[model samples]
Target: MINIQLLNKDFESRVRLGIMSILMVRDWVEFKELKELLDITDGNLASHAGALEKNQYLQVRKEFVGKKPRTTYAVTQLGRKSFQDHLAALEKLLGQP
Candidate 1:
């Protein structure tokens, strides 16, 4: 019988994967920065980000930069640890451990 269990899934969805991938690399990133990295549309990024924020895995800050609005995101401590664990699991699953 083939197993149907999920294995080493870093994210529940692809958009979330992209977000986590970026966060895993940098200490902090701007909203636009993530958008550019994933090449995803604004709405798409927003939706994905919303989910992350809801989980408290990402922290968001909004501020004004000389009359311009700017938004930035940083991975929370929990996020960093979680992503690391996820990666480790993936490596093990792929026989890379």
Candidate 2:
């Protein structure tokens, strides 16, 4: 039987998956960039980001860019590992491994 327990429920959302995909390649991503890239509203992005933060999958940094506040996100090591495991599970599911 194939094991299908490795996928993380937290990352099941496409928005969250997209966030992880972007963060996996870069050290950090700005909130505005994510909002625009995902074509999601502030509240939508914030809600998903908040869920990730609550899961300790990502860290949020808030700072001032000039006078305006800028928020950035970075994936935690645990998050990276979790994402990798999830991908491996997907590959296994597809008989890639």
Candidate 3:
């Protein structure tokens, strides 16, 4: 039987999934750093981040550092739980657990 629970609609996109994956391991990530790592344009990254933020899956913080505005993103507790569940589902589908 197929495991429909393995699918996470919110994480279906490669970009979003990548973002969450990175956030899972890091404390926080700078906007530019994520953009560079994802090799995506400013607008593209913003759109993806916005979606995650809107879903309350991540938190966005904007601060001025030495007169430069810095925007950072971090996964929320809810996000971490959800991502872990999604990963578990995938592992189950793969018969790893």
Q: Highest lDDT among the candidates is held by which one?
A: 2
Ranking by lDDT: 2, 3, 1
Model 3 TM-score relative to the real fold: 0.91
State each model's CA lDDT, in order. 0.78, 0.92, 0.92
Kindly list the per-residue Cα lDDT of model 1 for residues 36-73, writing each as its tens digit: 98899999998878877887778989999999998888
Model 1's lDDT to the true fold? 0.78
- Any idea how many clashes model 3 has? 0
Best by TM-score: 2
Candidate 3 on 1-97: residue-level lDDT in tens? 7686667789989899999999999999999999999999999889999999999999999999999999999999999998899888877778844
Model 1 regions more than 4 Å off: 1-10
Error of 1 at 8 (Å): 7.1
Q: Judged by lDDT against the true structure, how good is candidate 2?
A: 0.92
TM-score between candidate 1 and the true structure: 0.81
Per-residue lDDT of model 2, residues 12-40, tens digit only = 99999999999999999999999999999
Worst 10 residues of 1 by lDDT: 1-10
